[model samples]
Target: MKLVLNTFFSFFLVSTLFGQQYRVLPIESYFKDISFFTDSSFTPIFPVSDNQVNYYNTTKEQKLRYATVGHYIYQREIIQVIKKEGAIWASPILDIQSGVERGDTAMSQYLNVRGLRIEGSMKNKVFFSGSFYENQAVLPYYAQQYVTNRGEFYPNSSDSSYHQVNAVIPGSARTKPFKTNGFDYAYATGMVQWQVLKSLSVSAGNNPIFVGSGYRSMLYSDNSLPTMNFRVNYTLGKKWNFQLIRLQGLNLLRVPYASNGEALYERKALSIGSIYFQATEHLRIGLIEGGTWTRGDSIQKQAVEGGFYIPIPGAATIQEGINGKSYAYLGLDLNWRVWKVLLYGQYGRNPYSKSSDVGQIGIRYWPFKSPNYLVHVEYNHTSSNAYKSSNPRINYSNFNLPIGHPMGAGVDEVIIRLRAEWNHLFVSSSTNYYLNQSDNYRQLLPVYEAASGTNQQVLYETFELGYNFNHGYGLEIFGSAKLRMVKNPLQNEQSYWFNLGIRTALNNHYFDF
Candidate 1:
């Protein structure tokens, strides 16, 4: 453990001398960059981590000759301690932002965030990265209610405080009280990767994964906290590629604390695999399979059950069908590019019930074959019990957040997004319509089968105008507006929000739902 700590700290400070390859790029800025996707030369299977290093190396940035400040601000990392012939490199990442949102009440909602990302590479065979973030925010009313209600838990027999605590923040680490009526939270994640062979690489980290070609995915999305996971990737020539992932997750509701009075959430394991085939230059198909199991039996705790390593697709589903030890699911992914338009769709089914299924379809079109402008439209639907199970422990979720869609289950949504860019200025807008159940669905909890759920409708819209200062860091100055109108038998809500701030946006924080 001491050696491990020392090695991690050393990498954080200064990268060793090795060629860094397969360094995963940040999602929001690089993966979602319209310019890169629209370029005909680039081929992507949405959020695959291995190909990023090659892409980064090919795209060179322009540098200033005489003005040191200009070079640092425009092209160079904020603090580049080592940059020797590209053999070894290390840099610090910073993202600080402050903004305000106006909603139902006279009081304004405020947000303040500070974060640091450390990335390094040791030669061509090894790479590592880490990030830390601190946040203090008075969120919108709906979001605040979600956090507070879910986190309101009482103390157990071995606990110190007798009262309840509301400290859980979705898509982030747990929180503590901040100032008056605000929440403060901090979290960290890191990764280390080693290339074992020319066509194979192994990595482990607490990282978020996105597995679709659209703004949302029915298979997996980065809407939840990053879980600790181990991954293996292999490439077989140009047409075949394979990947396997083992995820360690937490079920906070089962057992909140241990005898030592420390938070000891129930443990769960998930094994997932993907096989991708590039049948033609413009078409791609992928098969996704996974299974989840609880750490122990109903009577006592024990090691996780087996059946995690069967590589063939649909094997997990068959195994679950026979023994019923784990909950399994199967999905299919397809994408095709025709001229300037990209079309994609996904289908997923739960083995527990035939009615438990999900589907998504979307189209992305670039006018004039240019990346400067885009029009995106998508539709998604989930059955009432799509991700839920009779046993909460086996549900498809981690840390109380759904592993796939943020809308959870029993929801149908339509989305349209538009973006236009010129020079350094850009404007983007999004509109979403959702028809869902009144009670916010959570797959991690078992629901009452006899009770009838209310129908609700929500219309959410957002618009943003920003000036891009740097592409590599995703640094930008922006102002935004949001409108949300909800209608339901339980209650009705209408809110208008506005804010302005400068930020280095990287990860996707899903608050729109």
Candidate 2:
């Protein structure tokens, strides 16, 4: 371990020979609007929400959402009960209020939501932040099925016995019961970071993250579940940045899970190390290695080692051969900017395994050089077993949610998006089409189900128009429509929603797949 750490830091030493300052932000995708901003920033891998919190808290001023519309956001933050106690501070406030009515349901066919955010810094060295939400919804037919089974935990147990429910498609996801008419769940994320050195930082938390500049990532993606994870970032001047990430995830099962009377969650560890470069003003490239290891019957933890083989991105395979079973994947990213437009592409695969891989290519156009006004399109495809393992316990998932693409595997997606903004007024739309292999989610056995060649398909589209109100704490008034068409149905499934709400953050969770 000492040798590994030393070697890793040596790269930073060589990189910083010219000396460069490092910056970190707590929010996973905090530094945004790249199309309109000049500085180049590294994008953290998805679902690891607390990256660089210490760096950001110490070096950069918190970006206030009050874009000065009506100035109400500042007042709401008056809920801040503490300020400046020897470098300690706080901002605790309730966020959004929203209600949505969809499809042919009557007065109660709606969704209701409330949220909270708590943030602060301490001792000038540590920073922490958390967000919470309580939501209840009368989802469309497919959505209800997706969430319930997507998280299907059969028969909650008060202990020995279980409270079971009927299931469709063999089983369902883990779904918590809600009000008489809908389903409800609580989502929470909290993370803390500490600055250990001028050039290095550590962050640990549970949340979702998005990697890459495209609509999706070939390696890790936001269309997954929040994970309990830790991340380390080191900068070597202006030319190189390195990141090491580790995750402890579970492969959920349909039973009232118990391991020797303990809540039995499968154990899987992921180690990803990446090096990024700014070759020139317009060219950037990244090389990354990722390893997935499953803790079979024994849940003992594993060590993180040897994942940074640059010329060979499959270093994880070395340990996998010694161990019982594991998966290793590698990625290459090319990001090039031409004046105002950015073109990017990525490819990732596990050479140690078969029938599991992903490839993506996409571009973003900033017409008029405005971040708020933009067009994006991307194509992505995943082989059937991309994130899966022979051991169902090691499949890349938590709460039955994938840690990569929302569609799981054996899927291809074409996504297009358009957004136009004028200060407080905004209009955005996205359409995604999917060609899915039938066994995408169900083939969890030691071997993946063979592809049938023939596939199922789905197309989903959404349009929204909203205006920021006072830019206050992300408060806005919006109306939106969504439609999904499945291959068999032939007819489209439509839903509509409108609300007055505050969204202090983007929707990082991938529930729309």
Candidate 3:
């Protein structure tokens, strides 16, 4: 303990003597993919969205066509919205994509996306950002099953034999019934950031975030909607960094439509803290701690967490009473760089409180001689009920989405991703296999029971080919094949999906799950 503390102080003192400044790129992929980043690990060690994105790399403008009109237009970033240098400035963010696809079944496969964003900074001190997104689609059968099972957008009353309604999306109202079994969803996100000191910064926003650089997250994830929150970051140059986040979340359990007054989605307080160290030029380590607590009922309006108000480790367990209602999560990960290759792994457990464990191991290799080619392989597993809870309102979920792992609990998966880039074009492919175990414990119950069934096996694969016609903008063709096999009852199914489109700008690509 003493040695660790001394190391931290030594690093801090050295960093203070020559404090360097760095900002986290926007959580969006475009900013990340086009910015100055550390290979596949991405910008600033993957924390939260509180860091300001002060840099935008325009060097990759080779694929652009007529993007610059000899000095009047530069990548269309400032179509003259406000292009003054060193003064207040702003620009429009636009993305439009429409495509036609088909599956084996009769369901229509029409995919369309429309998005708009407005972002800018003033005097390099204050900054603002906002985005609006609208999407409509005819999803494949397996993806459709995942959405309908959320139990949100419908009342859940086990009072009768037939009291369940299949729903497509949470926080979503049916969109006038599309051609076939299609659905629609809309989202709005915004944030403001202020740089107070070279070593300190703060931001308040309602935007989704993925906390880890890996393909999946075991801590914080963007699968859920933007939770209104505040974030603060402290850093001592590019060597050491720290972050704290507090979010306002919602519970998805629903009440009957016949009730006199509907219950507001139950409120939840999610607090997270993390510290990362660039231990050496080739090695880095990160420590994360978090808590999820419910509000209302007998509990007061204040935070009743076991861990410190600041960042500290704790077991995110659910006890029978107060101990049972609250949850805490803690974990650590390491990244090792050997020349051009990167190796990483993580281990997390909620033992005493929640009888579950989680782990991940992965390697990313990008040949130093040829940095444009890459290969990544990873394995992830979550014990039964790892993200589940005895309290419906306090489980590791927001609305209908799991905040930790996308598969929730009781699943083992292997992921392999390969990518190659050549000037204006890129090709990539990924495959995933998940072995899932059905939960043995009943919902909202404090006890457990023995499982009476077998596990299910699922396989998912995807391929993509994209070409950039304009600086940072392009056309993409993508497809996926999913297969699920079950036992006991005996079942097997296969489905395929595809999409092709031209986009001036694009948002996060979340279908990777």
Candidate 4:
């Protein structure tokens, strides 16, 4: 088998050197009997104007055409069908990770197991890519029950899981194990694009949408919307573009919050459709086109109080609230390049009842033509009055509900990173500082609380490095450490992690026995 594989690879390389590269177009042609006009056998049949030949004579029916005015070749009605086949391309990657993390004081000393991940992409038009991951580290939880020094027990729970923990704690002597499923990730995505016109094309499939320059997006965050989304994109003229998308099933991988009392895995909802538009390569705007009715109840309505809130507070409140209703959003991004430096900024707003706004700006400096050597600095600001939680304490009770803290306020963060790369080797380091202030002032730490009664300010940081090799191999290392001094039960928390990865490719182009 090894010998046969080597022989196949040798022949594959030789064919790639001489075969005509595939070019997608409206029509294509290839003829062996066509006569070249430059040859003496071909003569101009029409009057020569300005010493220019008008037509060419050829024996093959596939090769009769008129010459254009300015030394151009023109084929009026010939259809080209070039038969070039047996092209193959593939990329595969495997990542292995091992890291240890200790959360505050109460969490158990856990062992970091090696996590494995494989991802790759193949193409000739049809492409496939996916990733899978698992880990044996500390998984985040929302509630827990513990015995105090007084021999009594305290049940810590979020608003959503309070009932479940309260009932279990009174009878159990041992601390109920907080359900943390170590580390988990998922695999998704397949897409296809077809060229329909010279300047227009269409693509449809399940894919991830990461728009704008901000690491976090208010309209759609990487942590929020990693699911199956069907989208269609259109290009108009040279400066305008449009997109329409319908997200049927949402895969909430990171954030586990759900108003419905169901297992995280069982909870599924239809996202309100959305439409996006871009003009002049500088600005983009998108809106949640409308709501979609599915089997599950509307979590948006449950997040609010009393099923719904009256706008006037009296005089017969609106009977039917905006349940399972649609929402709207708009976003804008701008990029400017001056010399070797580039600057970009993005701003977006989610116009739901509990709407939020986010903005970001960043600058990149590239002084050389290398793989990944650049200095980047960015700042992000997010403010929401609806979901702001003032509590600083970490809640490990229910993984499916948002702990009542402060909702609908603003948070600010600044990140500065420096990256250097040489060939397949790359190293990057960065730090982030978070300033969080919300409405529940008295519930926060004393160090940041002002006399005016506002939640205290806090900060978090992280750093990462990675490397990739030719022939589809790569590795990455990352670490995240947080320093917080909040009066809330959530103590100052910190953790560290590292990962190594490898990748390769396999291809069987039009295999024939």
TM-score of each: 0.86, 0.75, 0.77, 0.53
Clashes of each: 5, 15, 4, 29
Best by lDDT: 1
Error of 4 at 44 (Å): 51
Q: Write the per-residue lDDT of candidate 2 for residues 1-513, one digit (tens) a residue.
A: 777657645643442331221222323222333311332444434332223222222222233432333222432342432333312223332334344555554232454556666666554456677766665555555555555445433334454323323221111123356665466656777777777775677888875555666767777664445667787877788778778777665555333444466456445666667788878866778887766666553325454334422223455666666664566667887778787777888888766668788888987787864445778888988886687766555565544566556666788899888878676688888888886644234433222245443367777788878875432234456767666666643343445545444444333334355
Which parts of model 3 have CA positions greater than 4 angstroms off?
1-24, 28-55, 62-104, 151-180, 237-239, 254-263, 297-308, 311-322, 353-355, 368-372, 435-454, 470-489, 504-506
Off by over 4 Å in 2: 1-69, 74-109, 122-125, 152-174, 254-262, 298-315, 435-454, 470-473, 489-502
The local distance difference test score of each candidate is 0.67, 0.56, 0.55, 0.32
Residue-level lDDT of model 1, residues 138-250, one tens digit each, is 87777776666445333456743333355556567767888778888888877877878878888889877767677787877666678898888888887787888888877
Give lDDT tens digits, candidate 4, residues 1-513.
777656644543464342232221100000100111111111111001111111112211232222332111122111122224323322232333344334443343232323222221122222223333222223222112111110211222452221122111111111223345332223334444444553444545544443443333333332222345554445566554444444443211112354466434222322323333443333344333221222233122222223112211110112113432222234555545455555667665434434356567877666664324567677776664422212111110111221111112355667676667554355666565556544242221101223243454444344445543331112233333323333323444454434333322111000000
Question: What CA RMSD would you report for each candidate?
Answer: 6.7, 10.2, 10.0, 17.7
lDDT of 1 at 297: 29
Compared with the true structure, the alpha-carbon lDDT of candidate 2 equals: 0.56
lDDT of prediction 3:
0.55
Q: How far does residue 2 in candidate 4 sit from its true spot (Å)?
A: 19
Model 3: per-residue Cα lDDT over 329-436, one tens digit each: 677877786876667777666544455677788777775444346677888888875765555556666765667766667768898978777765777777886766
